[model samples]
Target: MPLYVWLACGLYWMNGMATVVLGSVLPLAVQHLHTTYVFGSDLVFLQFVGYWIGVPLSSMAVRRTGYRGAIVASSAITALASAGFTAWPKPLPYLVCSLANGIGMALMQATVSTSLIEWFPARRAVIMSRTEAAFGLGCVLGPLFASACIAAGRWQVAFALVAAAAAALAVVGAFTPMAARDSREGPRDAHTDAIHLANRRDRALVLALFMLCVLIYVGLESCVNNFLPAVFVEHFGLPATTASVAVSAFWAAMVAGRMATGWIARKLPYRPYLILAALGTLCTTVVLAATRSVVLGYVECVWLGLFMSGIYVVTLVFANHAFPDLTGLVTRLVTFFAGLGGATLPYAFGWTLAKTGSQWADVALALFAAVLFGVVGWTGWVTKRKSRSPSERVHAAG
Candidate 1:
């Protein structure tokens, strides 16, 4: 493996930890800030709003700074904002810090993903799955760290650790070797041209379907992560510390699933893999909705995490393969929807949870999972239909 790949993994590991930092400590943070759950959700919303704003700007950042500079700058911003999160124990300041952290995370994520796709185009899916496994590893550890801090009545320390990690990544990004922009571009292939020549309507439909998948998948995952601890506490009467462990278990399953996906994706077609994963997610969400046992709750969390693990990464790889010429644009657009989903869903879930209950919230998540399954299935059918040889199409017509 290349040294840069290891650096990318390190960056992703930090990104994963930062991604769930707020969620892991949400209950304690809210109590410390003397705020409500709704306020916490609002902070989540603001952070992802920063993500929404940052995606397009990330492209500009890349253009101006190149990959290394963008990575370093984003890391520095994340480190600063994460530190700011605990500096003031007020609502407004925390909100501002959350938004800043979101922007930094979005910029770094987009830059790293685009670079990896370019750098390892031949092994895109496998490499992406591996890096995402690193992300899952981070998610698994983040809540455990937060849980320990919460147990010690030092939940704020989690943010400090995130800050320290991001700062280190900033230093590493500065010194890491990266391919120059002009040097990374590969010659266009016939498959790329074939995609360009395909029916415009079909192409648009495929992209739309994939984007919808990204949006729903991201939203559902974010909602679950942000609120699972609360759900475990309220619905199952679990202690706050115990609830945080549920989050870790969920991501531990995710790490396992992603590690398996790197190998499974090589044998299984992307379309079928996506369909199966989506279906698995829907099943788990439904089971989770119906189950009331605390034991079942933990089981469902792990199952849900395993099923949801590879949907986002595999979808991105599939879309990139479909529209090879538009990898960068597709990445940005997909990430933009991811931000949109992450921004809206959790806040909506929080509001719904406030108005209704965890049961209804679980129902909503199951519904979203069903929609994801449908979308993935539809995308598979469309792509398969489109991919048939002209003779096959003619034979079918005959």
Candidate 2:
């Protein structure tokens, strides 16, 4: 791996850490802010608002500042916003901070995903899977740290810690060697250029499929991560500490799964691997929804994480490969939808929990998984149908 890859992974780790820690501390945040649980989850919503706002600006930021500079700037923003968490019991200030954090996340995400192509052209799938594993590792660790902070009655310190870490990452990112153009502006592949020009409709269909897949998956995953701890506490009557541990286990499985996926992607066909992952997600979510025992629920959560690990990265990588010329555009579009998902779904999850019941939360997640399975399966059908057209032409000639 290059220095840029390490820097990118570091940013992703911090991104994951901050997002998960916010979820883990939701109970405290709600109480401190004097809000309901549904409203407390708005912290996740606001951050993604900043993310959506930053997506369009990220392209210009990267162009002007260079990838390294953009990363440094975004990291600084993350640090500043995280420090704002110290203004606890004040909803307005905290919401403002969350919005800032989302913008930072958006800028960094766009730059890192785009830069990795230049960093490793041949091993894109493997690198992306591994980089997401770094994110999973952060998720695994961040909640435990947050739990400890909560236990010590200094939950705000977790935000301070995130700020300090981001500051350090910004410093490291400043020294990394990444070009302003990221090698995308160099030469064009005539074959790819021709393909993009000729197959406009196919390209549109593929892009649409990927964007929708990313949105639904991100929404489902965010809802689970943001609200799962609350479900455990409110429904199962578990302590916050125990709930945090459960979240940790879920993310630990995600780390392990992504590592495994990086290896498997080398051996398996892309479509089949995706089908298997979707199937696992669907099954695990069902079991999670049905199980009543807390121990069984924890085990199911681990499976859900493992199954859900690489879908977003794979989707991003696939879109990049499909349309190399539009790397930045595709990155922004997919990421924008993803941020939109993160912004919307957690609130919906909270709303469902508030309106219907906790049991319905799992049902909602399962439905999302089912939709993912259908969409992936539909892509394969489209490919098969398209493949048959050539044979049909031959038969007509015969």
Candidate 3:
């Protein structure tokens, strides 16, 4: 119920929204900026770099300067960067602004991610999942709104709108309180909590299992999310717009799935819920592989979104409980690679599809699904075996 928590949530939404919002309109931005589409996408590359480097740095800064300063600074920087993108159409300005925005976004995600873990530890899964769902909502809303601006040929106007919106977030965040980083919570118990969270019921096996599951989950989901438009174009011989709608469905399903996970996490522990989700994902992948219908592809996309909504967050939950104190460090490490996986997987999927056919992509999905099952099954067995022990978490990290 703290004001900083509210502010952090708002920033979380903006950062999440902005990152996804650009994906839909990157091609448009490139044309408008008088640069290669690859140049505009360089923004994403820079953003990834920022995310890779800036998150841990921001966490360290937050430790020293507090989230209030870091959050406000990041917001202002991002807003200004976005404003520049809107106002200045030249290539240099565009790349500069874009990379700055990337830096700001990375700092914002890292600082806020750590702040949230601290703010709502007792309900980490539900709270994180719900807040993240707002991000999923942003992924849809940002492009939807921007696409409208594009229809009017007002790309700058759209960037201006996002800029103004981000600036407003900065204002509100400036007024929010810094979270309690005080040690009245005690170093001993804090360290204890971190340990209890880190050591899984099954020692090192759970982390290994979770990471494998995540790698597969991320691989297939990213491939589909990244390439659905192209797939629809080739497979169904549809217009780009038609394929885009399917992409929208994927994101919307992701939002819905996150909401569902938040509700389910309240009822189930990490292991069972993920098992069911992975299993369901496996079934959907099977259906997708067997069918050649474009409609079925869309349906498969929805189910993929459903499972993915929780996959990363669930991994985060497992990580947090198993590694509380090192949460930021661990998050940056894992997410950096996950981001790498997501970025690269799509091209691989597309390349294979081009060489062979659309059917090969399903093999990738099914392979990913199989990986998830192996992960979930192994984790379940390990977790169950160790439930009777006095402590569940150990320091075995994957």
lDDT (C-alpha) at residue 178 in model 2: 73
The digit string of per-residue lDDT tens for model 2 on 1-398 reads: 55676777888889888878888888778887778877766777888899898787788888897777888988999999988886554888888998998999888887788777555555667777778998888888889998999899987787877898899999998787774333433222111111232377877887788788788888888887778888888767898878877788889999999988778766765666667888899999888778889989899889999898988877776667667788778878988999988888777888787677778877887887898888877755554444445557479668
Q: Decide which is better by TM-score, 1 or 3.
A: 1
Tens-place lDDT digits, model 1, residues 1-398: 56677888887888888888788888777787787788978988998998987788789998998888889988998899889976776788898998998899889888888888877776677778878899889898889999998899888888888899999989988988786233333322112112232678878898998999899999999988788998887788888889989888999999999988888776776877889999999999999989989998898899998999999998998889888889899988888899999988888888877678788888888888898899899888888877777777789999
Error of 3 at 36 (Å): 9.3
Evaluate candidate 2 by giving its C-alpha RMSD to the native, one decimal.
3.9
Candidate 1 error regions (>4 Å): 180-197
Stretches of model 3 off by over 4 angstroms after superposition: 26-46, 80-101, 153-160, 181-225, 289-294, 347-366, 386-398
**How are the candidates ranked when ordered by lDDT, highest leading?**
1, 2, 3
- What lDDT tens digits, residue by residue, belong to model 3 across residues 1-398? 45665666677667655665455555455556666434533555555555556666686778787877787778888899878877787777766776687678767876776666766666667667766787677665665666566567664565676687789988888776675543323111111112222244444565655556555665566565445555565567865445556667777888899988777776677767777888888888788778778878888878777876787777777666765566666666555555455444544665566566657766766776777777777766665555433433243321
lDDT per model vs. reference: 0.84, 0.79, 0.65
Clashing residue pairs, backbone N/CA/C < 3 A, model 1: none
**What is the total number of backbone clashes in candidate 2?**
0
* lDDT score, candidate 1: 0.84
TM-score of each: 0.95, 0.92, 0.77
